[model samples]
Target: MLAVGAAALVLPLAAGAAPTAFAAPVSAPVLRAPAGGYEELMVPSKMGPVKVQVQWARHGGTAALYLLDGLRARDDRNAWSFETNALEQFANDNVTLVMPVGGQSSWYADWTSASNTNGQKTTYKWETFLTEELPAFLEGYGVSRTNNAALGLSMSGPAALRLAALHRDQFKHASSLSGPLNWNAPGMREAIRVMMLDAGRFNVDSMAAPWSPAWLRMDPMVFAPELRGLPMYISAASGLPGQHDRPAGLGGAYNTANAMGIEVISMVSTRAFQSRLNTLGINAVYDFPSNGTHSWKYWEDQLWKARPHILNALGA
Candidate 1:
């Protein structure tokens, strides 16, 4: 009788908490069509309010695609919008484009702790934000919480695969463009530390202790088996310069060289990830272009190529 009365008393209090918990989201701006353009949103998160750019489906479709940015993501706009013609290319697609801005050096992962460096004011809870907070709010906009896709380039490439693997119920299609897929590889931790430091002086230790279970949890290769039967598009380019690399001066030459080296690493890592998937009997589309570099041009091309597959997977 005591247990029964306790349950009955808790029901009303629990019901009361629901409105309080969802009060902020209830007050959030609604998704309104802007006459065939992008609509900006401020999604509430534990880290803070995050700015997200959205392009509603041209034909009023509900399927959404999340495009994650690189390590040096900017606060003003997502690279997919400014660096590439992704917005224009997908303007008429029957899928919503969700691009989150401002996550410099954050590999779209939940960090262990908040860093006080590089103007980081809150703990990076990106995984939680994407999977939990953002999805719940998007449901209000007629988007299916489960029927969505995720794609990323460079640093966020592995993150897209990892998110899809771990949260299979949320993401139906996943793609990686020029992403370093192997996180536990030798020297990766140190390399990531240097890169993160250079990007925004972020401390890699805050992401996860080197090689710890937390860090390993973010590796796409470590969770390759979980991606079995999921639609995946993996692409990488050779370090050689392609039509996109036009060296103009010393600065252009240096940039091209840097892109070449980065592309080489990405190609090797993507190949290893493919091999791991093969061992697991997982099938995925792989694009190993003959000659290219780790630049927006190559990534832009990959995005175009992956669109049909992504649409097919989402039934959009």
Candidate 2:
């Protein structure tokens, strides 16, 4: 079982809990369509209220696609909306785009213990917040309760798979782009520890005990069988610089080198997980491009490539 910290238990909003600047009532917010293009809602959770950005569908479809972010997710806006043309790509699609903000290095998991990172103490209860609280809250605002799909990149890639595997009835389809699926693989734990540290001085050992059963429990490869019948899409790059890469000078070269190393690890882990899925006879759309690196360009391409499948799964 996943360990829950004492401070992570869900509780009623205290009498004088801190009020959010934009929305009233720390527990719930009035859900309304954005005045312009998108709206932000503060969904209450055990850890605190989570800010979810919603882009209403032009066709008013009830189905939703939850898009998670990577280790460096910002609190301002989802990288999908900020860095890419995802909003424009799905403008005509008949599905709501749900993006949860600010989960840097959290891995979107329920941590065993509260962690102090950069001097801020947080009890990470992202699993409960996303799967339980956020869904229920979205349902009240006309989003489909069960007809949902999830996709993530990098750090959140495995999280998307694990959520779909464990809550098969909730998500109709799932996808991951450049995510590490095999958590317990050799050297993976240490790699994650270093990544977390680099991301925000986060300690991975506090999120899940080192080499514990919880680690295995969260590994998508270990639960590959659970995702057998789900319409799934998985993609990864070979860590090689392609047309999208434009190395300028020494700084650009250094950045590209770092990206290559991370993508190589992701490629190895994702391929191993995909191999397991194939061995288990679980059919999924696999996109293993030989020349792309771990960049938003590839993720954006994969999103467009998988758009039809995702919409089909949602019955759109």
Candidate 3:
């Protein structure tokens, strides 16, 4: 149960050992006729809260795509939610848009060490919340579990793959947009640190900690062995080997900043990690569009592309 830390989650501890509590989400927020022309709902989640948006037929679509957040992405909104007019995309189709509210930088792991004591932490019991709580709620709300898949961007990329990989019964399709799948690399870590610092949201304890053996154990790549048969859909920007802006030459043949000694963790190519997947016979579908970068524009397009895969996974 170490992986399932209890009582430590932010909860109230009364003198009489009573429970701590937050007013349970009475009425989740939903905005119909979105400004961008979609139905939007700011729903509560175990991780915290999510903003669920739908842009399909009025029949309450059967298939779903659970969108995840990046390290700096906020639960309040998303790149697609803020920018695109998703409602226009589903005028002819039926699909449910489910965005779980939290996990910025969470890497979407069943985090064994990131809860609050006494359910008091703003961060809720997410893994349980997502896999069980949220799913049940959605089912009640008319979402069919039999036709649900997940897709995320950047930091959430690995998670999208992991969820489907680890729980094929629940999620048959998963995808990531501009995500750094091989976080075990040095250059990738540094790039992340730089982004964290720039975003002013970098917390060593929050990002990765030696004290929390849970972090490593939660990583998807490390546990890919447990995830088989789940189809993976990936889209990422191209760049240097996990490291960007590398100085190169003929002798540059042997240079690597990704401490793991991955011959070349290509930011421009999904080489390193894909090779491993190839070995495991898990390369379902991957794309390294020569034009995309690790940015919002690329992800928007990537999400659009992954939508078909999401539908396929949902068997819709």
Candidate 4:
């Protein structure tokens, strides 16, 4: 077993530099058990060394599925492992599960400028890290370089779509569950600013300068044409409390209300993207449930529903 309390080392690189090959693991990764089997890897990046949790396929296939986290991603573990049964659900599948830890409010994008907070200067180069660095590192461990799919929820929904659209050669399929697809849609820019603040006290201006072209480039709705031929899945809820919601008493009521609002925003934005795809004559699998909220239960169900499609795209 690897030692607990492993020290993290930061090796910063020049801004906007290409991803360098990762050196040998700074320390051996801590391995977990079967149902949630995963290896915690500290991957070197342009920003800093980021933690990536990976669950190898039980069937030992080379195909990979990169699962991105939401705005409130924890530094310690991917919420998919902590909050859902994704590891067990994909245990027998012939695809590696890649989950990068931490990103709270980063939006998984390469920011225009760095932000200084609490005496630390941080630059979010997530797009480069995920697409170039992480995959290069994973190649040594038997994960495929080209046969991959990307999935994300909430904040990462658009990120996943944008990555697939921008790097069509790297990803074969993409799925967004309860993600805000249209970033520049009316009222969405402000909503994103507020959500980023609530998630990590992050400044939206720092992430993308006022009216930066990055916003237009990152908006999946704007780049839907780029995703025309790729297999894709998009899902969202109606924001209504449904069978999956089990709010307990007053706190539960508040949680339900919050989920309702977020899911409603997701529904509206996702529908707009869907409309754009239709206008482009691009076919994509879509799941718009009538009675649900923005919560993990629905995301988990969407993952299961989209799995076959993902695997099919991967030719697994």
lDDT (Cα, tens digit) per residue for candidate 4, span 79-153: 787677888888888788999977877889998877554223878899999899988887777677789999998
Q: What local distance difference test score does each model get? A: 0.81, 0.77, 0.53, 0.77
* Model 4 spans with C-alpha error above 4 angstroms: 1-37, 116-120
Candidate 1 stretches greater than 4 Å from native? 1-36, 116-119
Name the regions of candidate 3 deviating beyond 4 angstroms: 1-38, 42-50, 56-58, 110-121, 187-208, 211-213, 240-269
Collision count of model 1: 0
Range of the 10 consecutive residues with the lowest summed lDDT in candidate 3: 6-15
| Candidate 2 global CA lDDT score | 0.77
Model 4 reaches what TM-score against the true structure? 0.87
Per-residue lDDT of candidate 2, residues 1-36 (tens digit) = 001110111111001123334553234545542322
Q: Mind giving the per-residue lDDT tens digits that candidate 1 earns over 1-316?
A: 2222212211211111111111122236466423355677788999888888788888878889999988778766677876788888888888899898778778999999876567677999999999999888777777778999999998889989988999999999999998988765677777777777766688889989877988989888788889998999999998799998898899678767777777788888899999999988899999999999878878989999999999999998
In terms of TM-score, the best-performing candidate is 1
Model 3 lDDT, residue 274, Cα: 75
- Ranking according to lDDT, highest score first: 1, 4, 2, 3
Q: Candidate 1 has what TM-score?
A: 0.89
Query: lDDT winner among the candidates?
Result: 1
Better of 1 and 4 by TM-score: 1
